[model samples]
Target: MQFVCPQCHISYPATSQRLRCAECGGPLDVADRKRFDPAAINTEDHSLWRYRAMLSLPDGARVVSMGEGMTPLVEAGFAGQPIHFKLEYISPSGSFKDRGTTVLTTALKAWGVTRAADDSSGNAGASFAAYCARAGLAAEVFTPASASPAKLAQIAVFGARLNKVEGAREKATEALEAAAGGGLVYASHAWSPLTLEGTKTIAYEIWEQLGRGVPTCYVCPIGQGSLLLGAYRGFKDLLAAGLIAKLPRIIGVQSIACMPIVEALRQGLDRAAPVEKKLSVAEGISLARPIRDREILRAIRESGGDALAVSDDETLAAQRDLAQIGLYVEPTSAVVGAALKRLKVDGVTVAALTGSGLKSPPALR
Candidate 1:
């Protein structure tokens, strides 16, 4: 299997030291056009690493696991409303990002990489740091200055070098670029196919829980559009493998305050354009120009999915609603819950609870 660029169509070696396309520098995915196993189902392993054979990592690989898979897809009742929340915070990093870290960091460790660097709002940084620590590798995190302190602290606790950048995430990302001088791999959660590979496990679990069938609709917040992209590819794989008959219509929710991809989608643009970010509690879904923007939009459109934006206030209200139902999630996950009210669907729906609210801003409580 190999991954091709959504923008350039140039293929990159799957499971190689190389990630992005060298020609156009675009996002990559598995090359083979194969799908999931419909007839044969396996649920022996718990973490996202359970799909090891399909993954690019070496055989008998020593993976950095934190029991990050098989999270409960609990049905939630809030304000006389029916909703389902995927408790991703139950992962090792207190966020859904552990799925990706489990794959990326383990691959790095196996390849003899000693140090790494990445940028994130919170959950991803925490996930990377925890897994890298477990793998005995050094890590550095460059994050927006406005990012939640508690989230940054998680990376620090693991002894990862923490560099806070002022201004918007664009500025923070630039800071990481300026400071990076080779030797340290840019282990960006947004750029790591392994991380996305890890994320696909969520789809696998969801399909299994649904009696090995795809759901009617899948909703989640998109920052760099990792979760949505992962599920899209996973479900498509299942469809290709003849395990599932069809793919679920995906809905990617984002914060209106910093909605670049949403704006692009609304404008019918495939690539993500740069934008000035506005403050919001859902710090997780904040991205200006995601590398995989084109693929993200295509996934949504191909499945008749839509990308929508929600206000921070609406997100907080959704959070309160979920908390009432005993599902505590960060503002980003709440954003998904809020968008669900806006989507048109009439079947079993799943909204991935991307992170625990406890790790976000304290005012959320």
Candidate 2:
């Protein structure tokens, strides 16, 4: 099993230490691997590693994890429609990226990497720092200078070096890449395929929660597109292995301030054109340039799914709705809840609350 570049057709072995496609310089992933066997489901354990057989990891690899999986699938409603909230903020670092970092960090450690560098809006860096700490790997994170101070502090608290860049969210990637030397592995959540491998567990858990049935639709907020792509790749594996009969239509929500993927879909382009970066309250999903842009758009398109945008006001209001129902989530996660009113479909839906709202900026609350 291996990861193939969407742009270059260059295939890298699943265990390749190199992250980007050697052929076209595009991002890569462990997407094309086989699916799970219901017969092999390890109901005994709870973390994302429960789906170990479904991933491309080596046998008996020491997984660097922080108990990031089995997040609650909360039942909620809006306009009398049934909705399920996949609360991911309950993760160790208070976001879904913990799932990815857990697996990616372990993989880096297995590759003999003692130091790594990457970038994020907030959660990814924190999660990576935590796992890297556990794995005894040095981590350096570059983030937008405008991120939540608390979130930035968490990175340092984890003993990871932090680089605060002056500019937009997109520039964070440039800075991190620039700083990454031959000795430092770029364990970038946006570029690393293994990171999303851990995220695929969300799909498996959703299936288990629904009595082994797929949700009618999954509305998620996309930043680097890890969650969306993970779910998409997970379902694809399941279908290939005859684990599930079909896949859900993936609906992604983006902030109006910087909805690059939405514009890409609307324009029928696989690649998301560049857009001016804006400081949105939902820092986690505020990417103007995603590394997996083409693959992400392909998932949105192939699933017969659509990309939608919601205003900052609407997202904040949904944060209150989540709190009322007893889920403290950040604005990025709340965007999925806010997107429910905007969805045209009428059926059982799952909106992944990407983060816990307690992390929202004080002014918004």
Candidate 3:
């Protein structure tokens, strides 16, 4: 597959290390969309690799796996209604970011990359570090100095060098980009199209768990919009294969403190504009400007979905509510619960719990 810019439509070889379009600076996507063939599934493989036929990895690429994906879809009551919760936090790295990290790491290994760098608040960094360690590659993670101590420790424990940027979360990304310019592979979960190749497996699993049927709606928290966009792409593949009757409505949740995508949708804009960043309990989804904002908005709109923002109070209350139901998740994941309450969606619905409560600071838990 080749890397294609959605905006300028510039094509680059799939082996190109550039993360964004050189002409328009837009995020890249895998140009050749693979058709999903259920017959091609490796049923014996319980991990995300079960859908390897649909993934966009190069031929003969060695997979870097840690038993990621195939998370449980637990049915529970929420707001007096039955809801299916996709427990993505039960991953090897304690967050859903592992899905993306695995594919990215595998590609890096195939490309003969020995060192990689990435920036994340916590979950992505930890996931990348763990996968890099598994792949025997040197890894460096740039994180905000104010990130959760537990997550910072997790990254460092994986033997990846940690660079704590002193300012905002974006500063951490800036630091990683500077290093990437110096020849380090930027295994960016947010910007790299290969990451989405891994993440799209979530939809495939969800489809399988639902008896090969699609849900009426799917909900998830959006930071860089990987999970949501990936799910959208996966379901679209199913639609193209005539496996599902139609695409599911995908609702993206964001913290009110930093809701660029929500605001962009509310204003009917094609792209998200920068918003004032504020401290939020759901630090994972507190991005002021998502790199894939336009693609995210397009996915939501195409799927007949809507974007919603919830307050920290609502998110915390939802966290407690989820814990009471035996589903403990981070504040970022709880935003879906809050949004669900507001939506009161009918028919079959699934909410993706992206991160584990164990990853949160003790006080938040």
Candidate 4:
């Protein structure tokens, strides 16, 4: 497998430390042309690494894992329609980001890279710090000052240098970008191809848990489009492997306060345009400008899907409603539930509950 520019199609060695295409400055993808076989599935290992055959790790590479994946897919009723919920908040760091963190950190270890820096709202920072600690790699996580206190505490507890950037999440990302040029490896979950490779396991697990059948729709909250891109790639892989007939309609949820992808889709734009973001309780998905905006918009359009935005009030109501049903999730994850209130699907419909309520904003608590 090699890193291939999604635009220019230029290939780079898998071990290359570069994040984007040098030739076109476009996003790079781990271009693994190898076809996956269902018969090669590791039945004994239930973790995300069980899909090792399809992952893009080098031979004899040491894995940095935390038994992530195999999250529960529970059936429930939402908006008077039968829907499913993938409980991703139960992971090691209380978010789905762990799946990517494990693979990205492990890949960094294999490349002999030690110090790493990343920018995140909250969940990604904590997840990265935890995995870096497990991998014996030094980490510095930059997060917005408005991030949840619990998340900041979690990052610090994991022994990572926590730098709180004032203003919006973009400020933190900019701070990390500048620091990364000064010898620190940028382990951006949004920019790293390896991170998406790890998140693709979510699609595989969902397929297996549903008796190898694809759902009618997959609803996910989009911040930097990490999970959205991962789901798209995973379902595409399944289609390529002849394991599924078609990709499920992927609905991307976002905060109305900051809905770049939603606006782009609604306006029929090929790329996302910057928006004026406001303070939102769903801080996890409050990205004014997503770096992979084009890729995310493309994935939604190709899957015959659409994007939705909900108010903070609706997200809070959905979070409480989910809690009433014994599924307590953070308000950011609750945006999917908020979106579900408007969706009327027939067949199986699944939405990812990405973060635990413990990491939610103080108002929700």
lDDT of each candidate versus the true structure:
0.78, 0.81, 0.91, 0.89
Per-model tally of clashing residue pairs: 10, 5, 0, 0
Best by lDDT: 3
Models 1 onward score TM values of 0.92, 0.94, 0.98, 0.96
Each prediction's RMSD over C-alphas, in Å, is: 2.3, 2.0, 1.2, 1.5
**Model 4, total clashes:** 0
Shift of residue 106 alpha carbon in model 2, Å: 1.0
Model 4 ranges off by over 4 Å: 181-183, 361-365
TM-score ranking, high to low: 3, 4, 2, 1
Candidate 2, position 63, lDDT: 75
Cα lDDT tens digits for candidate 4, 249-332: 999999999999989988999888999999898888888888889989999989999999999999989988888888899999
For model 2, the run of ten residues with the poorest summed lDDT:
356-365
Model 4: how far residue 297 lies from native, Å: 1.7
Task: Give me the candidate number with maximum TM-score.
Answer: 3
Instruction: Write down the TM-score for model 1.
Output: 0.92
Candidate 2 residue lDDT tens string, 1-365: 46778666777776625678887788875655655777777788788778777767754568777677999988876645778888888888888888888878777777778888888878888888888889898889999898888788889999999999998777888887777777876777777778778888888889888888788798899888899998998777677777677778999999999899999998989799988867677778887778888888989888889988888899888888777878787888888878887676556688887776655555643
Q: Rank the candidates by lDDT, best first.
A: 3, 4, 2, 1
Better of 3 and 4 by lDDT: 3
Error (Å) of candidate 4 at residue 255 is 0.8
Q: How many backbone clashes are present in model 1?
A: 10
